[model samples]
Each structure stands twice: as C-alpha cells, then as structure tokens.
Target: MNENRHSVIVIVIIIVGVILLSKLFMIQVVDDSFLRRAERNAVQRIIDYPYRGLISDRNSELLVYNNPVFDLMVIPQEFSIKDTAKFCDIFQIEKQKLIERYTAAKKYSWVKPSPLIKQISTTDFAKIQDYLIDYPGLFVMTRSVRAYPDSIAASALGYIAEIIPRQMERDSLHYYNQGDYIGHSGLESYYEKILRGKKGAKYKMVNVRGVDKGSFKNGTLDTASVAGLNLQSTIDMQLQQYGEKLMKGKRGSVVAIEPKTGEILSIISAPVYDPNLLAGAAYSKNYNILLSDTTKPLFIRPIQAKYPPGSIFKVVQSLIGLQWGTLTPNTTYACNKALVACHNHPSPVNLFGAIRNSCNPYYYQAFRQMINQEISSNTYTDTQIGLDKWHEAVEKFGLGHELGVDLPYENSGSVPSSSLYDRIYGKGRWKYSTIYSLSIGQGEMEVTPLQMANLAAIFANKGYYYTPHLIKAINGDPGKIPEEYTTKHDVGVAAHHFDMVQNAMAEALYGTAMRAIIKDITIAGKTGTAQNPHGEDHSVFIAFAPKEDPKIAIAVYVENAGWGGRAAASTASLMIEKYLRGHIERPALEEYVLVGDFGD
Candidate 1:
C-alpha cells in the first residue's frame, strides 16, 4: 500500500513540472516587451559626429576647415561626484567650479548631455581619459571646431557660433541642436546649406551607468553623415592677401572683379580682424573686442557702405551725354577759372581734356543738355516719360537697386529720381543746376565699392557684365548665380561711345594719375576726391588694366585719404600690377601704401 501511494505522488509531481515548463516557454517567446524594457534600461544613446566640409579659394587653397576638438561632456542624471577632490585634480578645476558647472548643465537639461569643459586640447583630453573610468557619467566627445589655415579674409570667410534661439525657432528641419556650430556671417552664412551638409544619427547602446558599449545593430540602423560640399571661390588668395596688406591701417575698401565672368578676384575691407580670433574657446571675448573697435572692422564696406562715386561716375555721365546726342567726343568747353568753375584750370578743354582736368562746367553743361533733350524727345513727348526713360537706363546699369550678390547684408545705393526731387523740392521747382553734382557722381548718387567695381566691369565689357559674384563653384558646378545677371541691358549709348569715354579716362590717368602709371601697361582710370560734409574729402579711384583686353577691373575708396590719385589710385595700380605680373617692380609704391600715413 505504501509503494502504490508513492507512485501516485511522483506522477502528480511530474504533471505539475510539465505545466510550469510550458508556462515558461510562453512567457519567454510570446511576450518579449518586458525584456526589451529591461534591456533599454541598461543602455543609453550617444551621437557620433561626422566630418565637416572644407572651403577653398579659386586655386584650391583651404580657407576654412575643421580640426578635432574634445569636449568633456556629462549626463547630469547619471553623474555622481562621490570623490570631488579627485575629480577636481583630473579636470584641473576648483571643486566649487566643478559643482557650479555641473549645476549649470543640470539647469539647462538634466537628461541631455552638456559640455562641462569645451575645446580642450588633445593633450588635456588624453590626460582626462586616464581617469575617465573613475567617473561613471563623464565622457569625451570628439567634435569639430572651425580652423582657418590663413588669417586672411576673416570677414569674407566669416565664423561659426553656437546655434541661437531665434535660429532654432526658424529652422524646421531641426538640423541643429543646442551647442551645434552654425555660420554667422559672410560666405559662411550665405552657403550654410551646402557647407553644413546633412546630419546623421545612430542608436548606440550603453550600460546602466550611461557608458557606451557599441553600435546597437552593428551600424546597420546608422545613417552616415555626408561631409559638406567644398566651395571654390573666385577669390584669388594671393591677390586678396596683397590687397589686404595694402589696406592695412587704413579705413576704406577695395574690390576687384574679372570683367568677362564678373567673378570677384579680391575684396578687402581695412581694419579686419584675424579669423583665428573667432575660433576655439576665446571666440566670445575676441568677438566683443572686434565689435567694440572704433574702426568698425566687422562692417563689409565693399557691399554695405555707401559713398559718392565721385569722378569715377563721370564715365557713366559721358555715356548718358552721348546717348542723349547732346555731347560729342569732340565737344569742347573753356576751362578758364570762371567757365570751368574750378580754382586751378585756366584754359579751354575738349571732351578728353575736360575729363582729364575734371572740369565741373563740362559735366554741368552735359547734365543740363541731357535733362533738356530727354524732356523734348519726340518719341516721349511728356517730360515725365522722358525722365522715366532716362532713369530706367541708369537702373539697368545696376544703380538704384540691389546688385543681388551672394554676400549678406548688401545695401542698394540711392539714385534720386524726378519723383524724389518732387518729394524734396516740389517737382518743377528744382532745376538741373539744383542737382548738378549727380552728373559728376556726387549729391544723392551714392554707391558702394562693389557697385563701383562693377561699373569698371561694365566699362571693361563695353556694355554688359555678369553680376559680380565671390563664389565660383560649389562641389563641382558654379552654384546658383541669379538669372538677371545673364540679361543684357543697353547703357543707352552706342558701343563706340565707350571708346571715346575710355580714351578720356585713359588721358585722366596721364593728367591726374601720373604717379600711378605703370611702365608697360596702359590703364584707364578716373579719380575722385568726394567732398564729405562731415569731415575731409574721401579719396576714390576706379580702373581697369591693359585697356585692350581688360583682365581686372577695380575700385578703391580711402576714407580721409587726401587725394584719389595719391593714395587710392596708387594702391589700385599696385594691386593690378601684383595680380597681372605676380610681383610688383615698384617696392616704393607698396611701402607707401603699407605706411598708411595720410598726414591727418
């Protein structure tokens, strides 16, 4: 009876064991969500940064690039400073400072990783790595910071800064996160789309202590980040460097354009800051210094600052006079102290001589004739119709409107219309004499150095020009230049008219710019000492070299520099000679520019 009872009990135990095993299999295979939750709790996600793109000059010289920088990051939620003394020794920071930094990071976002120490050197990073095992939540993140190989072209290349709150709200793609670098100005900002590239993400697995293990799915789920496309600018680094050197200690701007393609070869604004100042950890301090400087180095004087074109504008006036059939190439005007309306000249002068001498009366006569002839035109009998036609012709030459260059914050200079006169002086109440200075590129006719450079380009091309652009190519193709650039607009003058005006300009270099003459090169140039009501005259010069097939067209404006021919013309000629010949034969000219003593 005892054996039979034992056998029944064993059978019962075996049946219970079978039911338990079956339940275990169901829980393990059919219901896995709880396991996944447990696994997720053990690991955290970390971002892997990719390389950024490079910026190069026309000759493929690197302008801006990225260098690896390590940041001491900490996940506040997982972080614990148990041995504060050892942590302070490892990071080389005071215990209180470390606590303060951690507190600040937590305030920003506790769950998110924040930088405890930024832009630490490689040596510092290596030393920190030795003690990283002791700190559970602290890790080194390999990131890129902008590096400028050459200190030149700081303003043009611009700088990268932390993504701001405003930018975060405006951008929907969420391309950037807090502490991400973004282009702040100039070409860097203009081509941010191509230069920024695309961002990628990875699912990284980490332990319960927030330490990364490896890729979750062996990188199969990872999206590779593409490096930003390289930009090849039309800017010639050598020329740009030389021009910047020439402009040192001066307050002005210089712009050089290739006439055929309208490609900017060089753009220099004086009192520029070193690009290195905006790089690495000391960026904010240096930026504040630059911003507060009295010279206004951050201002892009080429595209933004407006100044009277001065005598350089006479070329355009000559074209208008010829187109209106009021002044011929042979038209002569007396340059006596009374007729010429200047204190210096005392003889009669022809059109060429008038421009050479910069006689005020000649341009005054031409201005009056243009207004009168336009008002009496048979095709446009109405005075307003004729005036509008004249204004339209001027506008076509890229005056009175934005030139649409790729640079940011370009200003459209003012070109007064008859309507403007009516607003100011009640229409017919104002006469040609009231605004005669406009004929000589003064009065309400304000232009930027970029515009003046483009005007030289127009003269070089005779009647047409491509929109002046700094960027030549992005990746491979010449990036999106505007369509309006391709459309040609008549200057309201015959092609032959350019020849006559160009001759006068050529003669002006001989008459007024004798000091700027190159031995073998025939350069056509005009000089202007624009009157500044606020202070002294501003020196300005516009020119193109080798008159026949103009290679480079340039404009130079020097604020408070006495004469256009003295400082402005000399600097422009030196730049041209250096660019064309790859060297300057005249060291004295370079020395003069470098000295920058305009005898205030």
Candidate 2:
C-alpha cells in the first residue's frame, strides 16, 4: 500500500512540472508581447528632421529663412519629476499646466514620445536646457521656425504652423506627424511637397534613468535625412519693397511682372502686416490681431479683390474691334452727340486719338458696331451671336477666368454671358443699347489685379502671353518654369494691331496719362477711373517700360482715389522709372506721392 501511494505522488509531481515548463516556454520564446515591452524600454527612437528649403528672391535676396527652435517632448511612461517647483519655474509653466500636458501626453501614448510644448525660441531653450536633467522623460528636440530678414512679402511668403489632427488623417502619404510644421498658404502652401524634405530615424540605447547612452546597434539601423531643395522666387525684393512703400497709406495693389518670362517682379497689397508678425512664438497672437482689424491687413488684395477693369479695358475693346474687322486704326467715329459723358478730350478722333484721349464716344460707337454685326437678318440672333463671339475674344485675353498664377485663393472674375443676359432680360429681348455701358468696361466686366497685370504682359508680348508665375527658379534651375507657364497663349489678334494700340497708349502718356511720362524712358500707359458706389472712383493704371524690348509690365489700382492720373498713374510711372532707371530722378514727384493722401 505504501509503495503504491509514493508512485502516485511522483506521477502528480511530474505532471505539475511539465505544465510549468510549457507555460515558461510559451511566454519566453513563443509570444512577442514581452519582447516588444523589453525593446521599448531599452531603445529610444529619435527622428532626424531635415531643414526646410530656403526661399530667396530672383535677385538672390533672402525672403523666408529658418531660425533654430526647440520642441519639448515627453515619454509619459518614464516621466519622473524630482522637484516639481524647479521644473515648472525652468519651463516657465504653471504646475497645473504641467500636469495637464503630461496627462495629455500619457493619454496620447505612454511609451512613445509626443510634443508637450512647441516653438520655444533658441534664447528660451538656452535659458532652461540645463534643468532638463531634473525631469527624466522630458527631452529637447531641435526644429526650425521661419524668419523674415527684410520683413516684406508677408502675404506672399506665407507662414508655417504645426500639423493638426485633420492634416495627419488626410495625409495620404503618412508623411507628417502631430508636431510637424507645414506651410499653410501662399507660396509656402503651393510648394509644400517640394519644400518639405524626407525625415530619417535614429535609434539610441536608454537606461532606466531615460538618458540616451549611445547609438543602438552601432548606428547600423539609423537613416540619414536629406535637406530640402532651395527655391528662387521671381520676386525682386527691392522692387517689391518699393511698391509697398508707394502704397504705404493707400488702399490698393501693385503687380509687376517680367513680360518675357512671366516672372512676377513684385506683388504688393496695401495694409500688409510684417511677415515676422506671423512667425515663431507670436504667430497666433499677431494673426488674431491682424484678422480682427477692420482694414483687413491680412487680406491679400492682388489676388483676392476683384474690381472693374475700368478704362484700362478699352485697350482690349480696341483689339476686339480690330480683330472682328468692324474697326480699323483710321476708322473715324463722330463723338459730339454726347451719348456717354465725355472726359474733356477732342471729339471726332481717329483710333489712336480715341485711345489716347480715352474717348468715351469712340468706344461706345465701336462696341455698338461689333455687337450689331449682321450675323443674320434678325437683330436678336445677330446680337446674341456677336455677343458670344465677343465673349470668347475677351476670355482669350484671360479675363472672366482665373489666370492660374502660382498663388492660392485666386478668383475668376465673372464674364457676362448670353445666359446671364437671358436670365435678366429674356432671350432675344436685349440689344446693344441695353448694355452699352459694357462697351466702355463699366457694366458687368470685372478682373483681379493679377489679371490686369497679365493684360499688360499680353500687350507687351503683342498677341501672345506666357501665364504669370511666381517661381523664377527651383533648386538653382531656371528650367523649373512649369510647362503651363511656358506655352504661349495667342489672343488670336494680329500682331500689328498691338503696335497701333501701343502707339495710341504712348500718346496717352502725353494726354490722359501725362503724369506717367519719364523723359529718359518712353513709357506707354493708360488710365481709368472706375465708378465706385461706396465713395469716389477707384483710380486704375496699366503700363510697360521702354516701348521697344519691354521688360517689365505693371498694373496699379488705388481705391476711392479720383482720377486715374493722380495716384494710380503717378505710382506706376514712379515704379517704372525706378525699375528702368534704377532710381527715381524725379524726387519732387516721389515726395508728392509719398506725402499725398488720396483717401479723402
């Protein structure tokens, strides 16, 4: 009996030992959960972020550059604070804020590191970095914040901010992280993919104290980051700054472009805030301040605001009339009937004289003839046919459409269509007399300042135009001009027709645009006073320099400033002289513009 009992006990003990051994094997060798936990504690993975690309002007002038900044990261699972008071004081944070940030980080991920504080300036980081040792899980990581050296081009250069949750989810490539900086708007947003370079990873061994000891696996597992490609913008910073100065006290926009290449020289919208205002630590604060102001300093008017092309559009009308064969350079129109109000210029003028004097009656009769072309015997069919044909011609000049410039938020100004007129006056019911104001560029046509500048470039190139763009070169290569910008868009008007209109425009430098003349350079320009219901007429001007081999084309607009010659033409003339002559020799004129307040 005793022997049988001892055998039973030994059998039971053997079964228990087998069960224990199998359980140990499963946890130690088969399952990877414990292995992953071990690796997480032993290794620290650091991301090596590449520097964002540098932004410079076509003149090699730095516009947007990066300044060193720091982000505070926390691995919540390992966080230990020996002295809470010292830690809070060093970080310039309240005790409650520290608790909140730490709790949020832990909720995000206990084992992985997350950004606890962002965009600390280098000076502030230097002030507190030595105290970092007191907190075990806290770490300082290097980053860059955008800086503006010259402090111009606030709206053009744009600003960068941290990637939000929405951005991360929408990141189809999974390229950005929670704290990654991204270009939000302007040139920055347009070139984001090219500007943001590849990020790399580095692995380091860590102790219980959470100090990085050395590279894990002798750095074999680490990857190197690549810096972003640099960009050279078409902006001539000097010209841009000068244009900004010219518009210091006014409400307007100025756009200058290189006609041959479609490179933007300068784009200035009045009431601009310093680009630095939206950079670094003060970004949100300054942005809010700028946004709340009634004048809307944050609004980028060149691309944002659309106004009637005013008298400057008569140049387009002249071309349209010439192209349709209803009018010629010598075609005479009797103007003494006073159909539209006159601007005190000689009546019964030729085409060149009509353009020079900005004769209201000439365009009225000329547009009437184009609209009344005999497409069919019926007046309605002919008028609709003629209107549609005229609309197509105007759209060819890039009006009633977005110019597709590099910037964002550009709007296509409305082109009055037959459908629109039908909705208003019913089909076959309206005639040219019903919309005669359209003949003079006043009724329903509107355009952005960018499109107006492109018009100047179109005339500069005669019948063809390169689509306007902001980037001149990328990664030091001028070959980067997009294919869309390089292809010539012919307006289908005869080349010689531009020559005749240009001659008439030159005559305007003596007549309507007398203030635009520079004795050293022969500048061709036109002036327009757009009627404004809110207040005084908005002054408008368009011009190109040196008549022959024209280099720069420009458009200028000043709101509520009566007479296009006074503020708009003067400003354009000064800018043209400055760009061509390298200095404004007419100091008195410059002073007059700088000191004058046309706002009244």
Candidate 3:
C-alpha cells in the first residue's frame, strides 16, 4: 500500500510540473504584453515640432512672428506628486485644476503623454522647469505662439488655435494632433499647408523613474524638423494701418488694390480687434466676447459683407450697355421723375451728363432699352432673352459669383438672372418694366467691397483685370505666385469703350463728387447713396487715381452715413491721397473721416 501511494504521488507531481512549464512558456514567448511593457519603460517617442513660417509685408516688414512657449505633458500611469502645494505654487495652477487635468489625462490614456498645461510662456516656463524634475512622468515640449507687433489686420492676417476633433478626424494622413495649433481664418487659414512645416520625430530612452536619458540608437533614427516657408505678402502695412485708423468709429470697410499688379495694398474692416487678442491664452475668452457683440467686430466686411451696389453699379451698366450696343456715348435721356424719383438734376442730359448728375430716369430708360430688344415676338420671352444676355455680360466682370480672392468664405454677391426671375416671378410672366428697379443699381443686385475694388481696377486697366490677391510673392519669389493671379481676365468689353466711360467718370468727380478732388492728382470716381429703408442710406464710392497712369484702385462703403459724396467720397479721396503722395495733405479731411459724423 505504501509503494502504490508513492507512485501515485510521483504521477501527480509530473502532471503539476508539466502545467507549470507550459504556463511559463506562454508568459515568456507566446504573449507580447511583457515585451510591450518592457519597451514602454525603456523607450519614449518624442515629437520634434517645427517653427511656423514668419509673415512679412510687401516691404519686408515683419507682421507675424513666433514666440517660444512650452507645454507640460504627463504620462498618467507614472504621474505622482507628493507635495501638491509646492507643485501648484511652481506651475501657478490651483490644486483642483491639477487634479482635473490629471483625471483628463488618465481618461485619454494611462500610458500616453498628454498636455497638463499648455502655452506656458518662456518666462513662466523658466520659473517652473527646474521643479518639474522633482515630479516623475512630467516633461515639457517646446511650441510657439504667434505674435503681431503692429496688432493690425486682425481679420486679414487671421489667428491660430488648437485643432478641433472634427479637423483631426478629417485629416487623412494623421498629421495633426489634439494639441496642434491651426489657422482658423483669412490668409492664415488659406495658406495653412505652406505655413505649417513638416514635423520630425525621435526615439528617446528613459529610466524606470521616467527620466529622459538621451536619444535612442545614438540619434541614428531621429528626423530633423524643417522650418516652414516664410511668406511675402502684398499687404502694404503702412497703408493698412492708415486705412484702419481712418475707419475707426465708422461702420464700413475700405479695400485698396494696386491696379497694375492686382496686389492687395490695404484691406480694413471697421471695429477690428488686435490680432494678438486672439492668440495664446486669451483666445477663447476674447473670441466669445467678440462673437456676442452686436456690431460683429469679428465680421470681415471687405470680402464678407454684402451691400447693395448702389449708384456705383451704374458704371457697370454703362460698360455693359456700351459693349452690347444697347447705348452709346451720346445717348440722351431726360431727368424725368415720372419714370423714377430724381434729386432735382437738370433734364435732357446725354450719357456723360446723366453719369455726372447720376440721374435716376436716364438709367431707368437705358435699362428698358437693353432689356426689350424684341428678340422674340412675345414681350416676356424677349425680356428673358435680353436679360439672359445682360446677365452673361455682367458675370464676365466677376459679379454674381465669388471673385476667388485668396481669402476664406468670400461672399458671392447676387446678380439677378432670368433663372432667378423665373424662381421669383414665373418664367414667361415677367417683362423689362417689371424689373426696372435693376436699372439704378437697386433691386436684387449686391456686391462686396472687394468686388467693387476690382471693378475700379478693371476701369483702370481699361478692359481687363488680374485677379485680386494678397500674396504677391511666395518665399520672396514673385515667380512662385499662382498663374491665375497673373493671368489677365478680359471682361469682353472693347478697350476703347473704357475711354468714354473713364472720361465720364473723371467728369463725375468735378460735378458730383467734388469732395473727392485732390490737388494735382487726377482721380476718376463715382459716388452712390444706396437707399436703405431700415435707416439712413449707405454711402459708397469707387475710384482709381492718376487717370493717365493709374496706380491704386479703391472702394469705400460706410453704412447709415448720409450722401456718398460727404462720407464715402471724402474717405476714399483721403486714402487715395495718402497712398499716392505718401502723406495726407488733407488733415482736415482725414479728421472729418475719423470723426465719422455725416450731418443730416
């Protein structure tokens, strides 16, 4: 009985030994959890972020630059701090804030590193970095925040901020991280790819205490970060600042373009905040405040605000009428109030006189002639045929559609078409008289300030215009500018026709827009008081300087201001004189615009 018991005990021991060996084999080689854990403890991946591109004006004036900042990161599984009070004192954060940040990091991933506190400035980081060594699982990553020295062009230059989840999910290449900063509007957003350089990576070795020893593999596997390409924008900083100063306390916008190059010289939206206000720690708070404001300080009025073209649109009508042979230089009409209300201008005026006086009835009759060409026997069909041709002619001038300006969210101002009329007043039911409101730049017509500036540019160019753009050169190379901006877009109007129209516009300055006249400077301009049933009329003006050799083309719009001559014309003339002469000879006029008071 003793021998049988010994044999049974030996068999039991063998069975237990086999099971133990098998389990040891599985733990040692079959499962990868142990290997992964070992690698995690030995190696840490580090991101080498590149410096964002610097931005400069056309004259090499630095507009945007990067300032060094640091982000505190923590690996939640290894994070621990015994002296909470000391930690709070060093980082300038509350104890509850630290706890909340740690909890969030834990929820993100226990092993992965997440930002505990972001965008600590150089001064702040210097004070707290030494104490970070006392806390395990904590290190800093270098980053940059954009700084604007002049603090101008807030809407045009734009601002950058932390990437959103939707943007991250849309990134197919996974280039951006949760903490990455990206451009959110204007030129910054438009040139995001070129401005954000390529990122580099390194494998770092760490001790059991989570102390970074050095680069892994003797830095053989490390990749160097490449600095982003700097931009040479066409913005004239001095002119931009001047325009902004002139637009203060006024609800309007001013846009200026170099007629020869289509390079944007100045773009200003009134009630602009400093670009620095949207950078770094104050972004969210300031953005929320701006968003809630009634006047919409955040609105980019130059390209985004849609306003009725007003009488300035009559210039477009003259060109279209001249092109289609519907009207002539000597075509005459009376200032008849029976057709449309007139402001007591002289009667029996020719095209030049009508443009000078801005007669309502003259354009009213001219549009009737253009829209009733009798192409079809039916009056409605004939009007549609004529209107379709007119619409086609208008679109060629870059109206009724986005001008493709190198900015985000440009408003495509509406142009009334037969299709639009069809949608509104059924297809074969409307006639020329029914839509006579379109004659004097009213009705369904609308335009942005940028478009109006380009219109001025077109008149300056005589028949064609280069697409208006902000970027004159890329990385100091003008040849690198997009071909579309350089290509001439012919508005399909006869070049010689511009001479008559240009002459008439020049005459207008002397007649109606007398406030726009400059000493020894020949300016061709037109003014419009856009009727607004809501309140006072919107003042409008479009002009190009030195009629012989045009240099700058500009458009100005002031909302609820009285006559176009008093406000818009005066403001535009000041901008013109400031740009051409390099100083304002009319300080009184400048002060007048600055005061922003248009009397009743």
Candidate 4:
C-alpha cells in the first residue's frame, strides 16, 4: 500500500511539470499579447502630422499658407524636470504655467504624448536646442500653423482650434486625439475631410531617457503623412478686399455671386477683424477679445443674418404673378388705400414700372390678384391652396431655405408655409389682405444675404441658378464639386418674363438707384428700404451688372441705413466697378460710400 501511494504522488508531480511547461511555451511563443505590451514602452509612436491644406482665391492668389511652428510634447509617465526655473526661462513661459500644463497633461494621459506648450517662437525654440536634451520625454514636434497673407475674409476662411471632448465623443471614426486641431467654422469646417489630410505615424525605438535610438524595424512599419488637398476658392481677392473696405464702420453684409456658376465672388460681413487675429500663439487671447466685443464681428452675415428682404423681393412677387398668369409686364394696379403708406413714387405703375418705382400699393394689389387666382376652381377664401402656390414659387428662388452654400452654419430664413399660416392665422382665417405687407417683402418672410444674392443670380440667369458655393474647385479639380452645385435649379418661370424686369432694373439704375451707375456700364439694380420695427429701416439692394451679358450678381444690406438708394446702392456700384473695370472711376461715389454714415 505505501509503494502504490508513492507511485501516484510521482505521477502527479510529472503531470504538473508538463502543464507548467506547456503554458509557458504558449505565452512566450503563440500568444503575443504580452510581447506587444512589453514593446509598448520601448517602441514609441511619433505622430507625423500632415501639412494642412492651402487656400487661394479663384485667380490663384494665395489667401492662406502654412508656416513652420513647433509644439512641446511630454509623456506624463516619462516626464521629469531637473530645473523648473531653467525650463521656464528657456521656453519663456511662466513657471506656474508650466506646472499647470504638466498637471493637465498628466491628468489627460500617462503614456500618450500631450502638448505642454503650443506655437513656440523661433528664437525661443532655437535657444532651447542645447537645453532640450536635458529634459527626458520633452521634445519639439514640427507642425505648420495657418498664416493669412492678406488678413482679409476672416469670417469666410474661419479659424482652427484644439479639438474638445465633445468633438471626440461625436467623432465616430476615432481619427482625432485630445490635442489635435480642427476647423471650427466657415469653409474650414465645410471641407474639413477634404482639406484635412490623412495622419500618419512613425514607430521609433527609444531609450529609457526618451532619446531616439533609431527607427523601429528600419521604418518598414512607418507611414508617410500626405499633405492636405488645396482649395481654390471662388472668392475674388481684389473684390473681397474692396468689399471689406466699403463695409467698414457699417453693420451690414455684402455678397456677390457668379450668375452662370453660382460661385461666390466676394462675401463680406462687417465689422471684420484681420484673419491673422485668429491665428498663431495669440489666438486664444484675440479670440476672447473678439468674443467679448459688442459688434459681433464673428457673425457670418452673408448666410446667417435673417432680415426682411424689403422691396428687393418685389421682383420675386412679379415673377410669381407672371407664373400664376394673374399679372404681366403691362399689368397695372391702381395705388389705393388697400396698401399702407409708402415712400412717394409714381402711382399705379406697370409690372416693370412698379418695381422701378417701388410702389407699395402696386405690390399689394399684385399679391392680392396672385392669391385670388383660381387653382382648379379653388377659391382664395377659406383655402390655403392659392397662397401655398405663392409660397412654393417664392421658395424656388432660394428664399426661406439654405441655398446649400459650401460653408457651415447657414440659417434657413423662414418662409411661412401654408401650414405655418394654418397654425398662425387658423387654417382658413388668412387672406391676401391679412398678409398684404408680405407683398412688399415684410410680413412673415425673411432672407439671408446669401439667399438674396442668389435671387440676383436667378434673375441674372433669367430663371435658374446653381447652388451658391464658396469653393470653386477642390484640389484644383474643377469637376469634382457636389452634383447639386453643378445642377441648374430652374425656378420654372419662363426666361422671357425676366427681360422686362431686367429692363426695368436697368432703368432704375438711372432712376432711384442713380448712384449705382458705373461709367459706361449699364447695371441692372433694385433698391429696398426694409422696414425695421425696432429702429431705422435697413438699406438693401440686389443687382447684376451690364444687363445684357450678366457676370456678377450682388446683394447688400446695411442695418439702420435709411435708404437702399444710398448706402446699399453705392456699395454695390463701387464693388461692380472694381470687379469689372479693375478700378473705380467714381471718386466722389467712393467718398460717399467710405464716409457715409447712413446707418447712424
């Protein structure tokens, strides 16, 4: 019995030894999980950030370029400082600031690299070369910062800043890191994917001191980061600069579009600061200043500001009437008490004359006829059908909706639908008289400067329009734009109907908008004094130059500017002259535009 017991014990010991050896072999050879974890500390990943895309005007004039910059990175697990004072002096940063940064980086991650200082100056960076090796896990990473050459078009170009936690949560692709930068608004945000190139990384073998030993696996595992694709913007730099100058000291917006392509020529929202104000090391400081300013310079008015389009929308009324067969170029409506008081003009003007004269009663009567017109024998009263037709026709002109411009944060200016009226005035309680003010572009309608400019493009095209977009081409690929941008959006109105209106607008440049006329250039334009319930009226104008073969379509809105005939028209005229003639011949007109305080 003793011998048998000893034999069982010996067999048990042999079985235990075999199990331990097999487990060890599997962990060391078959399962590489432990090996990878061990290599994690030795083989450090160096992120090779690609150069951000370049931006240029349609004419190939460089608007934004990349300048070499440096960010000081630190790994919390490996970070150690021997002399805090020396570090501060070398980087020219406050000691407290360094401590704060170090604490933040440590809190964020222990193993990953975090930026301790961003956008260090060249002189300071050069001085730190000898001292940098002293601090382990502290090194400079080469990157590029955006540099605005012209310092104009701040709102259009937008600004880039560090990505926040919210962005990380929203980014399902998991591309960005904590300290990475991203486009916050404007064209930057619109083309972020196309403009932001793919990020690549290099695996490098490093010593315990964080000193680079050599490339891991001889760089076979490394990836080369490609530079971001360049953007060729539709904006004309000369026109943009001139528009900004014209808009100085005024609270307003100016937008110009190419009639044929719907490409934006120049878009300005004032009072604008230099784009440089939002770039480089002082970005955070200047950003706070801009945020605190009362003027709201950050607002992109061209596609965001919603206001009553005023008499500029009268052209749309005429087109709708023409579509309904309720009005014609010769259609006359007598000026009567049906419409409210208005600025003096010839009474009972024709369709063309009503626009040229801006007669309020004519528009009111015109809108009445349009809404009263029978649709399959449906009466105007106790019915939203006719009014709904009017709404559909108007929306087709790109009003009451975003025109899909290639920029972010566009406001879809409201166009009260028939259902909206059903809610507001009760299903059938509304009538033409109930919304008479709408005929003159007042009541429930609102339009962005971009939408208004698109209206001009529609008229310039005599019915159809391409979606207004800031990017003319991407990566120099002209045909690579969105399908909708290249597609023509026909308003479903006949082209011939626009001729009379164009002729009338041409006549107006010699009449109410006399100041809008350029030397030997017959521009077609309409002036609007959009009523403001709060304060003074807003000056608004929509126009296209050289009436015959239209090139540029523009819209201008000057807040609290009494008459569109002055402020809006003058600005439009100067912009047209500058773009077409390459210079301004009307010095007196330029003086009026620059020194005018119509808004005040």
Give per-residue CA lDDT, model 2, range 538-561, as digits (tens).
999999988888989999998888
Give candidates' CA RMSD values in order.
5.8, 3.1, 3.5, 2.2
Model 4 lDDT per residue over 1-600, tens place = 999999999999999999999999999999999998877877988889998899999999999888788898897778787787877887788998888999988897776678888987676678777877787788789877788999999999998888888878989999998778889888887888888899999998876655678999899999999889999999999999999999999889999999999999999998888988877789899999999888889988888888988888889988878876889878987777545776667776788778888888888878877777655454545236667778888888888877888889999998876788778878667766677788888988899999999999999999999999888788889888788888989998999889898998888777688888876888999998887898988899999987889999999999888889989999998999999999988898898889976543
Among all windows of 10 consecutive residues in model 4, the one with the lowest summed lDDT is 374-383
Q: Which candidate is the best by lDDT?
A: 3
Angstrom error at residue 185, model 2:
1.2
Model 3: how far is 114 from its true place, Å? 1.6
The best candidate by TM-score is 4
Each model's TM-score, in the order given? 0.88, 0.92, 0.92, 0.95
lDDT of 3 by residue, 223-259 (tens): 9899888988889998998988888878888999999
For model 1, the stretches where C-alpha displacement exceeds 4 angstroms are 1-45, 82-100, 108-111, 207-213, 336-343, 374-387, 478-492
For every model shown, the clashing-pair count is 2, 0, 0, 0
Candidate 1 residue-wise lDDT, 1-600, digit = tens: 999999999999999999898888777888888778976675455566666668889898988889888889998878887778877888888777788889998997665678888887777777778888787778787878888877888878888888899988978987778888888888888888878877777777766555567878787777877788888888899999899889988888999999888888998888767898888877889989999999999998998989988777777877877777778888877654453346366456777777888887777677666765544434223444545656777887788888888888899998888788778887567665567677677888888999999999888888888888878777767645446545464555677878977877887887788767999998989998877887878889999988988999999999988789888998999999998899999998788888977552
lDDT of 3 at 237: 92
**Residue 307 displacement (Å), model 3:** 0.9
Q: RMSD of model 3, in Å?
A: 3.5
